[model samples]
Target chain A: MAVASAVAYRPPRLARKRTRQAVLVWCFLAPSLAIFLLYRIIPLLWNVVLSFADWAPLRTIRWAGLDQYEEMLHDDVFWEALWNTLLFIASAPVGIVIALGLALLVSSEIRGRDVYRTIIFISYPLMTVAVAIIWRWLFDERVGLINYVARSLHLVDRPIQFLNSFVWALPSVIVANIWQMLGFYMIILLTGLQNIPPNLYEAAAIDGANARRRFWRITLPLLKPSLFLCIVIGMLNSFTSFDLVYVMTGGGPGRATELLVTYIYKLGFSQTRFDYAAAVTIVFFALLVAIAWMANRLSGGNAGAVETD
Target chain B: MHRYPRWPIHLVLVGVSFLMLIPFYWVLKTSVTGENIFAYPPSILPKSPHPFYYVDVWYYIPFARYFANSVAVSMIAVIANVVLNAMAGYALTRDFPAKAFVLLLFLSCMMVPFQATIIPAYLITGRLGLLDSYLGLALPQFSTIVCIFVFKASFDAVPRSLIDAARIDGLAEWRIVWKVMLPLAKGAIATNVILAFIWSWNNFLWPLIVTRSADMQTLPLGLARFLSYQEDTTGALYAFCIMVLAPGILLFLLAQKEFIRGLTSGATKG
Candidate 1:
């Protein structure tokens, strides 16, 4: 009986050790988990609930089922903003294509490639507000560099009001957005380029494939993951570029430059319509999740940085 | 391999680089020269460049106060990121119950962009009584999911034998993290520090939403306000832009390798 009791005690001690480890792991994870819970998980759930209610900071709360969404359906500004958001996203591939070209160029064996890469990448890390300011001045009609050059070259007889014109506001803003994000796309593609095994290119060469053929066959196929990443990131950027739009044109001359994010901001804080803003938030969130899901599926379920396992 | 002439590539790259950098150069030229936008044939070079505009920006609109606010908030964010992310990352390396659930939670949290959460985030901050404070500005960014994974990747690379040796030596789990794991994860530390500082320093929306008082506004807010108030009439605003951009540029130039590495690793593993 004593021997049996000793063996039983050994099993209990093992269980205690396992429990101690589990406790330690939880302790280690607590602070970060707490932060995400408060800021991310809670806010997300709150946004969903808030979307279904008529609530503000100081007002009585009431159930307003589908009212905000109904209003959004009829709102021209909302439709315009949504359309502009899609346009902004549509413009992403333009930047990605340019970035891919830059990536291919920079990755080639050339003198001063690193310097060129650094200079190109330098713009990305600066504050977006400052970038917007710089671009705003550059597009200034009176003394802007772009106008100065355009006039000197006789591209236009008169200075164009790039940010103030309804026709040019969206495109001008898109150019600024692309300039800021170009370096980031280049870097991502550069990393992807580096990761491709050189032997494939060598084998293609041995098969008499031309440079263009090699790119179309091997480089393009292998670069799909990076391209998908750029696309998703580009979509995310268009959604979050509130500072740029707010500072550059304030979503004007009218609603031409208004994005969904800027609209949500105006509704919530500027107009104090938190309930309506919550609805917009839900729609925007849904759009992002759907885009992410589609990217995951399109990338064959291995979209970088998104896997849940 | 066919060796192509490099000059065309260099020429193309140089042209691209010029396009990328002309904005900074133009801004700098304006800031220093204070040239009037109305002037015909703007001087190709900054004629008689002076430091007066920079001085003007310094005294113009509580620049020092905004600078201090940015620094303090960024410091809190950077410290919290390193500590919290390291602990969380180290914990992830060990097998435990519900580990998969936790990873899934973090991944989903990453999808919730901060822009999408501003409404509730603001209300939550108000409830916590942190609104109009530095903590509110820094709290949302305290533990970036990407940085957590950065630490995880780095710690996962540390040989298991070393951790086992520490365990056999009777070192507690937390001590092993502090003494053994951190020492071997210097690159990850650099990545976290630079990324955290950049994100916190450049954060505009949160500061704009959270701070009601003028004194609590950050550099980005200050620059934006200065732009709205003065419009493009003054070089001081351009000077302010340069002042706001300097730290981030300097940090990037100083540790660009680590910065790029951090971004690439995060993106690839993300």
Candidate 2:
């Protein structure tokens, strides 16, 4: 009986070691798994559940089953918000072009390229709200720098209300958005520029390719991955355009600057119509996911950082 | 390309840099000037620098409280992020049957945009009875998926021989992780801490919704409130923007290299 007990107690050494490793793995994984499950995974599932139920008034609690979505279909504000979001995405190419220009300038045989890189990238690191406020001050009709400069330079006869007018509001926001983001785009493109072999450019020179031709043929094609990266990032940043619009215009002078995210925030928090808000959230998320999926497919999966946005 | 002088490129770069600094200059100029902001031909320099607005901001609004709230939230998030991400990251690099699945889960979670999760997350905070608390605000940002990948990459670069040697020397797994693995991951850790701090400190949406009381507001919330509350107090508004923006800008300037590395390297790797 004693010998049998000793044999049982001294389990296989390899098996015991394996068990210890498994325990260690679990120990390491538990915290991250718990946090992600509670904060991210569970909430994502619950968002879908919340979308179908009417919990706005507790006494009228019941599953609506697409009623909220139906409400969105009739809501003009919803369509306006969707259109505005698309416009925001459309405005990204402007920033990307400016960024590419800046990247090219710095990547050349510039004397102060490093200094230019640092200075140009400064705004990306600052608080979004702060950056927005600076632009807001600059947009001030009475004493704004932009208006002052424009008026003095005889460019415009009058002080334009950049954020107040419906026509100018969206474009104004886009310009500010582009300025803050140019540095990020420039740096990423700069990395891509560095990776291109100097020999290719030199060989192109030997083939009598002029600067403009070289840019169109060699530089542009070789910079595809970086260009794709900028496009995706620009799209992502534009759609998530809350902090800037929130500070600069608060989604208007009207619904001019209203974005999908801001509209959802207003519906849920301000109006307390959470049921309707959840439905909007679901639809908006689906659109963004679809865009991401399409982008991934079109890029042939070579462009990584699908969610760095 | 060598046929032309590089001075033209240098000139263009300088011109752009100056354009970039213009807004920052205006903010500084406006915040300091005591003169009417609406004055035609706005002065580039402050007429008489209103240094008092900086001090008066604390009394005008609960600036100190909001600053404290930001610091507390950021620090808590950073600590939680470091520990949880390191454990998960280290374990991920080691031999494990469920490794691929765990990583796939992490990557999937990474793709979950904040806008999508925020609505249900708000409800979750309410259910947990943490809606009005600091923990509720910081909880979502406690550990990021990106930071975990950062640590995993960092650990993968650390030779496996060290871990085996530590095990052979009778070092406990916890000790090996704490002493051996962590010290080597200083760069990644620093990157995560700074990024977490900036994200939490600059966070507006979650803080705006979760905190019901006036005093619980973070810097961004407080600044937004301050901006709207006194419509004509342009100096005060600019002053507040400067105050709110200074710390983040200063931190980035001081650690520019680390930030650029973290921003570019971790981003590309993930």
Query: Tens digit of lDDT per residue, candidate 2, span A153-267?
Result: 9999999999899999988898899989999899888877887888998999999999999999989887877777788778888878789999999999889999999999999
**lDDT (tens digit, per residue) of candidate 1 on B1-270:** 656677889889999999999999999999998885658778889999998999998778999999999999999999998899988988888899899999999988888899999999999999999999999899998898888888888898899999999999999887898899999999999999999999999889999999999989999999999988988988999999998898889999999998888778745653
CA lDDT, every model vs. true structure: 0.91, 0.84
Residue B66 accuracy (lDDT) in model 1: 96
Q: Write the per-residue lDDT of candidate 1 for residues A1-309, one digit (tens) a residue.
A: 999988777757788889999999999899999999999999999999999999988889999999999999999999999999989988999999999999999999888899999999999999999999999989998899999999999999999999999999999999999999999999999999998999999999889999999999999998887898898889899888899999999999999999999999999999999999999999999998998888889788766664333
DockQ of 1: 0.74
Evaluated on the second chain alone, the candidates' TM-scores are 0.97, 0.95
Model 2: CA > 4 A from native: A1-11, A57-60, A197-218, A306-309
Scanning candidate 2 chain A in windows of ten residues, the lowest lDDT window is: A300-309
Task: Please tell me what DockQ candidate 2 reaches.
Answer: 0.60
Q: What lDDT score is found at residue A165 in candidate 1?
A: 95
Q: Report the TM-score of candidate 2, chain A only.
A: 0.90
Clashes of each: 3, 0
How close to the true structure is residue A303 of candidate 1, measured as C-alpha lDDT? 61
- Candidate 1 versus the native: TM-score? 0.97
What would the C-alpha RMSD of candidate 2 be, to one decimal place? Answer: 2.6
